[model samples]
Target: MTICTRFLNQSRLWKWSVLTVAVVGFPWGVGTSQAGFIGGEGTDNPSRQLKALFAEYWDDELRAGPLEATFLGDHRYDDRLADLSDAAHEARVKRDRDHRHALEKIAPETLSADERIDREVLRFTLDDRIEGERFRDRLIPITQQDGIHLQFAQSVNFHPSATVGDLENYVRRLHAFPRVVDQTIALMRQGMAEKRMPPRITMAKVVPQLRDLAPKNPEESPLWGIVAKLKDWSEADRDHATVAVRQAIADKVSPAYAKLAAFVETDYLPACRESVGLWDSPEGDVHYAFRARSFTTTTLSPEQIHEVGLTEMARIREAMEAIRKKVGFTGDLKAFFQKLKDDPKLKNQSEAEILGRYRAIFEAIDAKLPDLFGHLPRTDYGIRPIEAYRAKAAAAGYYYPAPEDGSRPGYFYVNTSDPTSRTTYTMQALAYHEGVPGHHLQFSLAMEVPGRPAFRKFGYVPAFSEGWGLYSEGLPREVGLYTDPYAEFGQLEYSAWRAGRLVVDTGLHQKRWSRDQAIAYLEENTAVPRIEIVSEVDRYIAWPGQALAYKIGELKIREIRAQAERRLGTKFDIRAFHDRLLSLGSVPLSVLERFMEQNQQTEAEPQR
Candidate 1:
């Protein structure tokens, strides 16, 4: 319903960063320009042709990715899954090449300013995608944490079985599962042949995940067990669907899973490298460089990112020390972190308490949102625990967008997998980030924008989205949410944790730090639990360069806000500035900066 800027109709979501569901993946779509497309000051307005090109690209890309479309709530491809064979890969490459050529033909100087920005965004998206494909990373499809199998498991949520036809369509997907799984196996074999395997420890995790999803019977499968959600279906229809699903699992799905599980557990796992860093892969340094640039939307090298991370880590630690002193802790910062980690006071003993606290945080934040934002989304959102099936693998919390038509409220999934270890300190910050002013507000506002190109309306840029999410975490501190010192400490700790990421991520992938080194760094610098630290570090190893986006994006946003406030002084209207920023949808930080400066000028000019 809302223009789906989200990716993975082909092979997205789970594989694209898969770190935080709130703002997943890289550069699927960016925000629209503050001004919508209008004819430039000439008769030669190629804006029409350019807009047509974007429409064509969106339509073709969506059709090529039916699962992605379904996730976007487009039912056109509900019955279809991606063709993940060798030919499909080639087709995607050619499609990108052709689109790049088509876009190159459009003269930017002849178009309006907004169209030129769109032109630039389209070119960047295609270029990054083309370069990534050239590396043939698709051959190494499943990492320790992400792969097609996880996507298959989550498709049930993406495709609701509201009607009997929906159930039938899902059964068809079940039958098609073997083909997708087999293609993935072939890709893995190719990756192995090329010596591009993920590290062994990471791969070990992947096999267990595959086992979790590979139910031998249809009744046990997530896809076939949604009997309660299908209230409209008759008993006969449900029974027929159930029987077909079981048979499909017996013949197609289970056998395919068996083959994959065997390939991974036996052959591939042994073949995987012991080293966890991506820098050790074939031409890995170069590949990592491109990814760093793509995710951060900057050409900062691994060395530069590592240095920045170190500097930021030290700075955040100093602030954490201040908090440690505030809490009357006599020992050093590491001791304080250890105490925070062990403190029973920080625990949310039950899932209901965790979810309930998040809901209350949402309500409190909701009432205060109008004070900060000039334009608030009409769309509402809800809070729920991350499903037990995926909770173990999911991050602190993830956000799901509301349908463009408002058929579904947006969802913020709080992970309660290890409840005793799930601290309450981060809940306020996480709630702000995933629920209200963070993802739901920014994403819903983008979807609610009227008359924009479909692509911009539903865009997903990692730096922009995640930057806003992180930036939002601090906004609540100003609004007075973290009342308790521990909660305030949690807020600082969360920020410090992100700062640590800048160091640990770059240290692992670039500096050749071992997985243990990465884990120890977080342990020393933040109060996050050991298991959570292990999971986060593993994610960084599995998906290099992605962790760089949050801090990089947040720093840029805070810089812009600071500069704007400095320049505008008393004229700086936080609400107006925020509304203007949200109005631009999801542009890159650089694009955001330009518009922010331009807006300052607009405000500074004498009244007409």
Candidate 2:
């Protein structure tokens, strides 16, 4: 999943923009450098003008979202945390409006085809972000799945720790944590005043996480991992950095978390709404509608999407049943789900065993990737168990992209909290989806694509990214993976799980389905463990319409591929098709479809 840090409440536009910014020395707003670019050679070149505009926006965004800059491998602002104050949010909105206005002045007809695509994407991004300003998402920042607290706590994992100066910058960020917490509390308080808050049930899950994060012993804090990474440092420097880190955590970090926890437990939790659906909050109906469009990048209404989900569930269920019978299971689908869960052979032996299996699965898939894609990422990836603090509430697996500068590799974090709850059957599908030929492959390559603007390189579109991930789970079948009957069932189960998400996410948020109702639907439809089903339902509750992206995205890609296969017939090449799809980086589904159509026309031309 793309990290949807809810520091600010802008939807897909904010989520991607927050992650895309890079460091440039130019100050925010039309700097002298930008003025020269726009007024110099760009006076006659529309493409240059637009490129200059995008660069200006990148610099402004990096200044505003420093943590994002650090994540992108730009350490210039590593010492600063995001300013979650109301003033900062208002400024961000104004900047987006300004960028949109600048974009509107450009004549798309005069630009090259590639620049036109860039302009359209930027226009869509700015419009969505501007429209999102009217929503109250920023007020209710904390959720079971994500918020300032969780992002800040886990941020150490992304910080550069190769040098002593890097550790010093981390110390500064640790010291800055209290101020961010206070800003977050102020927002939550405003949310309470406006009667906009997360579901009481979901907020209940956050208090413990906050307490876990703010342990009494400073050494026990997640931030201490930074000090642990100082393996090659001189003994004196390591000792000095450790003392500074410990002091900063004890004096600034832990107290801030404790204060935030108190605010949630004593004030925020009791005031949170009993309802789980976003429809219960202010302007919820309108917000849910926008989210559906934003995440899916389609015009489909909630009613239409819910119907699409039902059709997919029906179609995938047929495939699942065939696999069940192939394994000689006499029981029905629901019984088979239980059998899969209860069988010891299907459960993980240990955390080490889970990590080892994932590594092996990734290696096997890596060897086969050349047959399916023309290009692969130069960035490598690692498999690590999700940190113990957040593992309980985390997903089964998630992929975080590597930095563009190669300071670190992408990591696939597997939840080894409850080994028994994790199944061996789903491991291959999980590995493929989160690691090889999936998010790592797609995201890392997007970052590495040449000549793309910084925003396009690092930006994420949920439908495009998640849809590709879901599609990748099945792509291995063409290369002779998932030959095991049970593993094939696992792949089908994962497909069903994503399909079930479309139903459950819409059901909870749009149809007023109770939390239990959503859980019950997944429990009956997919072979996912009960614990995972409950967690998935809560995720859908916390993040409305996000789950819909996987199935919706996958279906569109599959449709486009089928069209290509028919058009090219025996001339079709899967490797070239994949290379073309990914080479465009993260685009809206509409943009992707248009590009693919143009490519097909070009391919069909009589002569080169």
Candidate 3:
């Protein structure tokens, strides 16, 4: 999860444990030498077969998604952008068919329980991906929230420009940017022909963002920041690289962005639907239902979810009201919310001060983690602000997983873009959710899980991952981390804020509420400032059904813990339950429920 787009999940155990990143892994490259499991290549062992299949598929898929590879620190495809044409989509279909056919070759009943879990994780992930392909996510290639530009911008930053060779490879991608942009334009127009375009209002916001992205000169571009970071290059090598980069940005990059901007303003905008909800489009009901099920990992309908959201909003508001009176605030919840918003102590902190606050929260968390969790990741993480370029469109904070090789630490990106408008009281809660016991720990542990197929290890399930992060926000109170009522209030406020998402997100997409109505609903229900309310409402509008994951997942996780506490009684080891839950990385919530239920039956450490 990047600062610009988040809501991904991670795993750890019941009182003790999970990154619920929603990645799909193919089993083509698994090897017997990995930490645990039988290695006989030709042996009929189902686990080995699953591992081998995933390993091989992972390798192929990595090559296929170059930007994904770059983010993962694999540089083999650094010189290229994804080919977003129909041909590429067709090729993906062919690959999916081959992978599915091969997967059908493995017998799940013959596999161990753990392998069976892995098999199902892989199975469902493929099902989701294949169904998504049919929906043609590529059909409408751009959105205000997610699109090629942000992907390119974010991926560009992660490129390791350690050498002139690296610089040249990156320049090659910059040179190829026009073709990708052109392909996206083609897809957008085709989507329009198919009566599928992102809402006009969303596109209106996107056009300006895209227009602002590419500067006329490469030297002025953020794309050159990587080149600027290369300090040790020989003068001749540096000169060669800089010249090539300048030329690429001037001749290819600027023109590509120009072409894209022109297309969006001239062609795409006129064709974009005036309606915001998916219901206005072809097969909109079915599409929104698929998205709802996909993100929540539950078959619950929008109406059901809307009802659930209302219930949750009421529950969280009661917690918030308790805090309001405890804080000695005079008047009603809304008045307290206004005071919380205007309280000078909680706002206007310098970016450094704000960041330092979060870092301190993490250090406090580190000291208490042992008391709270039985296990921890070997890889460490750090806190930072979102890069200036993306901070405007991005959420207030998000987690970036550590590199698999541990070359770099995981990051909790605080959006200091609008520092004055941001709240400091939420830093501790945000830190718990975005740093340490939240995303970084969960993601690292997921990757490190022994004998997990590549997909289960690195892939994502939103309900699992996002739920864990949301669960984590409340976890710090157990460690006495939210020592003050104000801090505790921040936790409850954020919880209600997410709960409000269900109402707002569902209201926007399924109930056919207008943007203004959604914003007003959030303002009435949650304590976030006006700025965040706007973005949160827009985020829900841009990406349907995603916001539901945090609360839905959190409730399920909380329910699991409650079940364990009820059944295990004095035997309920918080650490053990947490560890067992996390041992299965990136699982669907239903799967996690089954697994945790099975764990409750045993007094001993549950085996993976």
Candidate 4:
């Protein structure tokens, strides 16, 4: 990894602006400048202590979530859901402020370079949280894609499996659903007051999802089957548990959902702003620009990102045209895209079959891992279907990192709502993005690496984390994974998708583009279906600056790789290079470059 001289200082604030994976939260790790730490500056001891302190604060917060605790392999909170009221959120903010003040005693002059970076990260995150509390982000909480509704669906589907206790916890969570829903609405209202509401187009989809999740008949609900799946439990116990869960669902969860549904239908829908970009919202433009810098870990403006996206799109379009020719399509590229979309053979019929296909892809990808990585995660991984309630709006695939303690495997959820939407041509890239060389391998590796602070293991660096995932997509072809033309097209399609994100995300957030304008940009530029593009565009509008991470990270990683290859000459080993990159877990791109440079020097030294 390369280190940059640009020092992050106390003046900067880290913003939580990425909207792409809202339901999927990011890991907040604290790192300080110190020797013997992953991607550290090899100096500054007290900063290291502070880094440890940050973990305590973060882990304590996670411990409060019964489901999160279980998901993190910390089983103590398995039967509870943390209170989600406004007061609860306020307390959380105060705690963070307290932690921030406590850390302020340590001076930057006393710290090492890496410690300074960690301090900056800590200060930025804390300051951002404080600002967010002051400004309130919860009001604009609903999105067509990620949010509490989707997360609830996931918890009901994924975390409740296995033991009778697990089943019981699921029921408790169901009972707690009312508070959760109410809290979400409260947050949304808070955001609304701050002019931070989710885009009208995005919030439009929230009502249907609420309706889907808030089924009148509990028997027809997604939770009903998840509970029904419990094994070795008695029929009477099951019956009793079912009644309790249903009561919670109907009386509590459903009412809140109904209220929110009404809000969306009546209040929010009418009040919904027509603006497509975050810039149009209250303090939105500035907020989005800040968010862009935070997520890309670069100071590039939206205009710069927009231009970058256009440049990349043009480059990929040329490659796509080559594929079109190779496939013997005499028609224009647009016609070829239509042909691919209309093909019946390109899709699966059922969710199970879609998931099974992903599972097989995982196995195949696993077999080839030895060629690229010297180290691999021992934790098991699963390819599962998204819960029925949320699948309709979920991404084609998403990875849930393995629990911190390793009890639960990392999960890659394949959305099979409309199998045709998850086309066969796109499967390889999806597999790459979510499975090996993508989320699972990179995340699991980061969590287990020895000598790294616990925070680094779980800390999310979007530029580094998601960047690595996007970068991994192209790495498979480097090892000959995209042999088929269609698979190659899939690779291009995925690349096109990320590139398109840059355009539409910027267009929606900074350029005052309409929702339709953003949607049209994606449709014109990529092979993604219209609905997916529309859903994604709305996400960018709600979340701002998040869409920039993929291409930004990919471009940086590729640049570093090219530089390394040029400098190392014939001695460069692709597998070792990748190992060095991933083994440090997720760090800023600058830190990554420095690490890569050190590896070059180490490799260059005389063999003793």
Number of the predicted model whose TM-score against the real structure is largest = 2
Write one digit per residue (lDDT tens) for candidate 2, span 1-608.
33333332334234364233334442223455575343343455677679888887776777786776776667788999988888888888877877887888899998988889888888888887777778867887778677778878777877878888889899999999999999989999999999888898988999999999999899999999998798899999999999999999999999999999999999999999999998898888888998999889999998899999899999989999899888899989999998998999899878988988988898899999999998999998888888888777788888877776566678888899988778999989888888889988888888777777777777777888889999999999999998898999999899988888888888888899999999999889988999898887888888888888899999999999999999988888999999999988777899999999899878967784
- Candidate topping lDDT: 2
List per-prediction Cα lDDT, in the order shown. Answer: 0.74, 0.83, 0.74, 0.68
TM-scores, all candidates, are 0.92, 0.96, 0.92, 0.86
What TM-score, to 2 decimals, does candidate 2 have?
Answer: 0.96
Candidate 4: tens digits of C-alpha lDDT, residues 1-608: 11100011111112211101112233334323222232233235676556655565555455444444444455445567766676776677766776677567668888775566556656666765565453345565557655556555555544645556766777777777777767766666665666666656667777898887777887666666666575557878777766777777778666767777887788777777776667767677677777787678787988899999999999999999999999899999888888877787876777777877777777888888889888888867877776666656556777777665555677776777877566787888888887777877787787776544454565566677778878877778867778789878878988988999888888877787777787777777777777677666665665577668888999998988898888878988888888888886666666677777777788877789
Worst 10 residues of 3 by lDDT: 8-17
Candidate 3 residue-wise lDDT at 149: 75
> Where does model 1 exceed 4 Å of error?
1-45
lDDT by residue (tens digit), candidate 3, 293-373: 888889999989888889988988888889888878879998888888998888956888888777778888899998777
Output the better candidate (1/4) by lDDT. Answer: 1
Off by over 4 Å in 3: 1-45, 604-608
Error of 2 at 572 (Å): 0.9
**Model 2, stretches more than 4 Å misplaced?**
1-32, 35-44
The TM-score measured for candidate 1 stands at 0.92
Q: Is candidate 3 or candidate 4 better by TM-score?
A: 3
Which window of 10 residues has the lowest lDDT sum in candidate 4? 1-10
Error of 4 at 292 (Å): 0.7
